[model samples]
Target: MSRTIFCKKLQKDAEGIGFKPFPGELGERIYDNISQEAWQMWLEHQTMLINEKRLSLMDEDTQKYLADQMDKFLFGGDYDKADGYVPEGK
Candidate 1:
């Protein structure tokens, strides 16, 4: 059976990642608090941010920005949205 976590993002128990998806303390925190569903949502949001902002993974600044966004998206008050993006059928 899959593991479940008390998801910080969703504020409920949900399916969890089998391993840490990122590195360090923050990653450990995520593994302990975030659900697989919330992580997938973040992945979609991150993709939009990367595409709309033309961010380069090779740049340290871009990496830092994404990491900050990830933390905010998961645990902070202000979640980032891709500027000018409208969901399909919205």
Candidate 2:
């Protein structure tokens, strides 16, 4: 059976991810608090950030920036958005 958590991002109880999505303390926090659906939303947003900003994963600064953005996206409730992006079907 799948585990459920009170997902911080979604603000409701939902199915939890199978494992830690990242390393260290943040990963543990996410594992305990974030749901799979919320995590998938973050993944899609992160991809948009990477593509829009032309970020390189190999760069240390880029990694830090992404981490900061991830924190805000997951918990801070003030996440950034891709510049000039317009949702489909307006």
Candidate 3:
């Protein structure tokens, strides 16, 4: 499959998704109530993304593109959006 499709599938899976009576929202709450081990793994995987390793399995260019997209998705918009930070180069 294409890289974007593969990435999309991974994103959905990460959020505890698949065929079901409802969507993954309930799974998210279930995960919130899950054991420490599961939460630890989740944090590790999140770190991998932050470290730009989650896209390491893909080709180099695709990895860079995905990394940029992730950066924008997680860190874009107004500088004062969060409780802190006026953002860089403002």
Candidate 4:
């Protein structure tokens, strides 16, 4: 049986990730509160942020920025988006 969590991002009960998606306390927090669907959403958003902003994962500052954005995306009720991006079929 799949586990369910009170997903913070979705603000609803949903299927939870089976394992810690990251290392350390943040991973533990996500495992406890984030849903699989929400995580997938974040992944898509992260891709957009990377591509639109030309973020290099090798850069420490970029890593920090992504981390901060992830926190806001999941928990802080706000997040950054690619500047001037329009959704497909919009």
**Candidate 3, residues 1-90: lDDT per residue as tens digits?**
111111221233233223221136533443333333333444444454545433444578854554444333323422112233343467
Q: How do the residues 1-90 of candidate 4 rate in per-residue lDDT, one tens digit apiece?
A: 799899999999999999898888888988999999999998989999999999999999999899889888988657898889986789
lDDT of 1 by residue, 1-90 (tens): 689889999999999978899999989998999999999999999998999888999999999999999999998668678779986689
> How do the residues 51-81 of candidate 2 rate in per-residue lDDT, one tens digit apiece?
9889999999999989988989988658789
How does model 3 score by TM-score?
Answer: 0.26
Q: Where does the lowest 10-residue lDDT sum fall in candidate 1?
A: 75-84
Clashing pairs in 2: none
Q: Rate the local accuracy (lDDT) of all candidates.
A: 0.90, 0.91, 0.36, 0.90
- Enumerate residue pairs that collide in model 3: none
Ranking by lDDT: 2, 4, 1, 3
Considering summed lDDT, which 10 consecutive residues are worst modelled in model 4? Answer: 70-79
